[model samples]
Target: MRKLPAGRAGVAPAPLPEESASRPLHSVSGTPSPLPPAPRELTVRALVMGGLIGSVLAVTNVYMGLKTGLWESGCVLSSLLAFGGLSVLARRGAPPSPLETNLAQTTAVSVGAMPASAGLLGAVPALTLLGTQPPGWAVALWGVGLGTLGVLFAFSLRRRLLEEEALPFPTGAAAAELISTLHSTGSAYAARARGLWTSGLVSGVLTWLRDASQLVPPVSLLPAAMRVGGMGPETLSLGMAWNPMLLGIGVLVGLQAGLSILLGSLVAWLGLAPWLVREGVATGATPDALRESLAAWLLWPGVGLMVGAAATSIASQVRALPAVLADLRGLARYGEGWEATASRWVARAVLPVILLTGAMGWFAFHLSPLYFLLALVLAVPLCAVCARATGQTDIAPISPVGQFAQGAFGMLAPPLPSLNASAGAVVSGAASHASGSLWSLQAGRLLGTSASRQLLVQLSGLLLGAAVALPTYHLLVSVHGLDSQALPVPTGRQFKAVAELLTARGLEGLPRSSTLATGVAFALGVVLSAAARGRLARLLPSAAAMGLGFLLPASYAVTLCLGTLLAALVGRLRPSTTQTVQSAGAGAIVGESLVGVFVSALSLMRQG
Candidate 1:
């Protein structure tokens, strides 16, 4: 066991024999923290800051997901963004309470995850490819409606997953750690926040110089993008972002995931790409042409390995699902009828929104009533599955689940496949993704915060995120078509390809090579999951990440690895400063991301 925190004068609080390390480290001495409790929580400042931060993150997420087929943890990013903003408020005679901070984070993460959930760049574009371009209002409506539905189901899950099942929501735990550390211990975290701001400032300026260099030609001299071949679409390029965020993230994810990511980068860039080129598996005269060809081929295997690994990891936990569901039986009854009870919360407050959401899908998207109802029904179980997956790995394959929903609905509404795709993605993808965010709230539940408050914040942020993200999605699409290399909405491509293939060729349509790759990758995914139990797994790279590395250009992946290697070197040399370095890195990521958004907006305005 680790050393217990000292209570007073060399005395340590003894832990109970039944206590396990699985519990949060917050219980340092098997006792409540002595920090003064917040008298008032759920402040206006928290809501405003959370919404603003979430909107920024939503835009960033929408943009990044289109490019990378991945999203960062809202809990981590939102916590830092919120704290950095709120600390300024604290200095101006308006310090937020700890509970308020948690509430803000609840809102931030919920909405920050909105773009991916709402399928803005994922399933929505799949519909676009199949002759359906939903208006901005429909996009907003789908996002909020489905997200609220997810929130309702999430309420039912808290007891089952948190209290009974005791699943570890990794990202939520991270937020709680940040919240408790800052509010309780305070000084250590305050200094760390300084590192964040400092790095963010530097990253922001560098991003501006890199992205806006066309306007100021002198700035173009800076090494923003490192391209090896003819600086064209098919170049063997590198994104030398000059953004320190990757290094900081490396520090936080730790040496194992870091090294794994690094290894994947090397394997792809140093070994795989060249091998493919030599064998004529990937052929191009210029680097740019070859990369485009390579990415097309690589995405199949990459997605298969990644999703397969994640699914297999979740599947391994199936034994616990029955127990989790069984635990929910006791918590379903309402206390004393008319008087609202914990059990009746969903029935009384949420059922109306759900009904309205379904109606919206039926009317606006032209989804059949039966299919809409089916989607909602399926959402409950899938949300549960996603929530658990999120708790365990912080990686819920919501898009895949949504795609599954699409297939089910497509079978029923064979003629209007696009409509069914939209319904499935909105219902399953957005809702389940929203449900995954609930695990962050579970962290506050452990600390005795109000679940209702968390729900309020989440719903509010959901609205804000939907509003911002939908319009942002449209703007990005207008500027750079989804098919463009600069904005390759990969998940959307997957959805489109599947929809087209199923519609045209049916089962026989799947390419032989892709099927073979998927099978091999699936087996490897299972193998990785089996090997994931031991401490040595730390050195193991994520099968999903490696899969992504395969899809993305080698330069970007290699740069990411190099950043982490720098983090490893720092951790080895001056371990104490690693946290600070990580904060700086996280800040740099945000800073650069925001700058990218700004530059994109500038270009859009000029074009308009």
Candidate 2:
């Protein structure tokens, strides 16, 4: 599984243009496919394993996203784990085939993405913050509908993105490489597999000690009373979070993104927040409530920056749309009727899902018929942009899709937060699932697996993921609530802040200083995002990441930045061990997250 990088929601970097052309898939042993073609791709065992892995990941994602605003699509992880587990059973007459692995991976990734696709981690939580709670089943159905819509879109664009243009979806490519390596004779996977499980075990044990057993005390880098110029470190929220997942995400996202968050955190916590409190523009009744109080003011500018940055990134991605559309036209000839080929089946699957989504939106979310329908319509183009961007950079701009939808409905809808938020959810969910599906599809294509079978596996995983995601969300929310410090829900808070900002009577409801800060932040976001698309792209900070820094606890930024530096140091000092670090980091995230969910469930049961 890969977490969303900094600025991932919408401000993913522009695609690299000067890449090599497509080539045939080969094993790490420098040979064509080592495994023979499978008699079946979508076996019952594959579906079961996919669903199991996906369901676990769906729970983990909800916990991770709400706690840290970082979520992953578990394609690579699923591939590795499935291969390792199934290969053991291979000696009993059932061989572990690459195509079957692809099917399992597809199903797992689909299921893993359900939390984001269903808006459980963001939009739904934002709605809850605003006091609107849809029933759990409704949310699950809504997620399923959106996920299905995305899968259909992925099928439509597979030919254009994968078969024709041959964009390198790096994450998918990694999964393919893993499959190939696993299937190769005298494989090098044993070392990696060991590192993965070992790190996972250590992290899980630590999480248990810290959260469940309570034997380990919280670690703070600064004393609460450590002061500079009449301000204390505690007041500024300057501390590092001691969590394995933060370290893992930092390693994955790298230095630039970590520095970007640090930059934003310094600005918000040290600069803007202090000034606001000093000038009485922001207030809290007690010292304990100060951070929360300040966040209410900070998120406006943070969300503004995110929106601006996303807009710029989306604009840059738009240039590829014309070419993508032109290539898509080549799918079916003019002579083909509605019932002629695969396009007909796609249409049949798509139309009813679309209608079902619309119906669900109306009955469950109180979405306006015209507004929500428009959101679904807009998702088509936005999903195209997301697909192209992901293929190019392995970052799906799902947040940007929702941010765009929010902006559109903010103006068109009747200033209702629910209406606009639901619209955003519809668009974001569809785009997220679509991009996720493409990653799976990309892996399938490289392995020469059956696309149709992969599609079915994805749909099956979607249903299972939806079932798992909603209940897990409720469980976490029931234990932590939306406002608890344990689960800061930065993305959800951002969504809530944006909904309120869009619904506000212009700038009338905000402090004058806050309005000014928001304007400056928005402009800076746009300029920074534009700069990131140019020659200094690698050197510059991500505007969206900086914006997230403002929304998250300063400790999160500090810890994640430290992790980034740690990863960099490891890479420079011991290059050969870099992959080991990566595997350990990924394991840590999975380990801690799984334990975190288990602890949450235990806490919930105790409360009952």
Candidate 3:
């Protein structure tokens, strides 16, 4: 429902929901792994560092996601940062353990994920768009409530997805591997760390030049939009971002996702928009006119496709819901033991979720008892669908969930656009994402950590996230503004559109031609998403990537393509350089992102 571009652990972060810990097929061997006797994991030091690291990344995700719809997973990155930091010190006795590293990384992902996972990036802006902007604290509270519920949904199905199923849960596994490798090899991360830090430094400087270079005196126009050569009214305004992060993001995202983005860009910017102009459907006689035209028309198909594909994907997950419940029945009726205790803990953990569903319905959305109950009821199936999608494929198509919610509530809560959108954000934006996060949590279990402890960390992180999400959103909005030409709140804009459409007339209320076009695009998107797993799917683009391609300029998409090409070339020629290249790419993104954040602060200071 939210983001970290290029999949924080793209193939890994997604998780399934189950109560019990089943024996998953081992990473190497087919048998269940031997549960090693663990050491100190929930230490004071880990908590402090986890909180700090989580805060840093939380802010970064919020910033990056709003500026450019990219969110990086903090799991592996946080693991790298933690291991590098602790491995440097000659501690009192027993240096930091892999278990500790696991806990740190777990805490980082849990909290670091809060800002985006809470829907600050999506729902908050939509709320503003509808002219019913909530107080910052209220937004934060709502975010925390949703997060608590998401985690509960995830735990409910953890056992089935982790042990019974053989999903790799890539991000979780990668974190474990990183922790194990660092512990085993005494002094190895230095060279890699150097490469990472250096790349980041270089990237940061470059981004400053593009975004903040002109801030010397009274800042002139185009502070963020640095121009590339050959600009004219009709020259497409296709300029370079100078932000290496996009290129680095392309590398991390790899070929399939990159190519997908490029395909969508070409289709929308190069082909379709022009076709529309010639057919008199859209007018684009000048560069500015053309950009606006594409933004309006091109965005619809991208959104519709995402909606259609997600609907089909979620429908498939609904069939498996009965089995998930059946598997958990025993735990619900457990005899007294650790099993019963754990079950009780899970029950207590979910209590707030249940209570809050009603509270949010009554308080936030101002829904009647029945509507609130319906929202909770609807959330159950949607959560399952979200978790299942995350388990099978690392991609959690969040937009579809919200769109579905919008449609469902449009009829039920009719004409009240704000309530419909707000309720949808509750079900799809927050709860659905939380269920998907369990996919990653189950991975933590496979590595020999306690599920109960993970839940505790997650709840704590949510609190941390709640504290920061709204403030950060307001800060970004203050500096960047909600609708800046450079920093378009794409998710927010989309949500606003859904709210307006649903409230105003519903789909049937729209013109026949507009509906038909969007419907066709939606159908095509459904086909693409459903067939995403086919052998030929590798050649096709992802729904998000395609959608993003449509939304972003052709120049931006080109840079991403170039980075993807570099990774592809490296993989083919020097396979050993792949890891190094990934690190460098990641560093590039970090460096640029840090600079971007710094520039944002300067803007805020100047405003003050």
What clash count goes with each model?
A: 5, 2, 17
Model 2: worst 10 consecutive residues (lDDT sum)? 11-20
Q: Whole-model lDDT for model 1 versus the true structure?
A: 0.64
Tens digit per residue, CA lDDT, model 2, 1-608: 34323123221221111121233557988887634332446677788778887887887798889988878887778888778766765667678677777788888899999999899878998898888988888888889999998887887788778866777787887777667667764455776788689988998998899899988754465786676434566656677776888888888787898899899998888888767777777676665577667887888888878888878767877777876665445444311332136556665666689888888888889986787788876787788888887887677778877888788778877888777788889888988888888888777766766677777777877788888888888888888788677888988887777777788646776655678888888999999988877799899888888998988888888888888999899999989877678777778888988898889899988988
Give the per-residue lDDT digits (tens) of candidate 3, residues 39-107: 566676776677777776777778767765667657767777777665554265557766566667767
TM-score of each: 0.81, 0.90, 0.85
Name the candidate, 1 or 2, with the larger lDDT value.
2
Candidate 1 clashing pairs, residues 3+ apart or interchain = 234-287, 234-288, 234-289, 235-288, 245-585
How should the candidates be ordered by TM-score, best one leading?
2, 3, 1
Model 3 residue 96 distance off true place after TM-score fit, in angstroms: 1.3
**Comparing candidate 1 with candidate 3, which one achieves the higher lDDT?**
3
Better of 2 and 3 by lDDT: 2
Q: Which residue pairs clash in candidate 2?
A: 9-399, 9-400
1 versus 2: better TM-score goes to: 2
Weakest ten-residue segment in model 1 by summed lDDT = 1-10
Highest-lDDT candidate: 2
The lDDT-based order of candidates, best leading, equals: 2, 3, 1
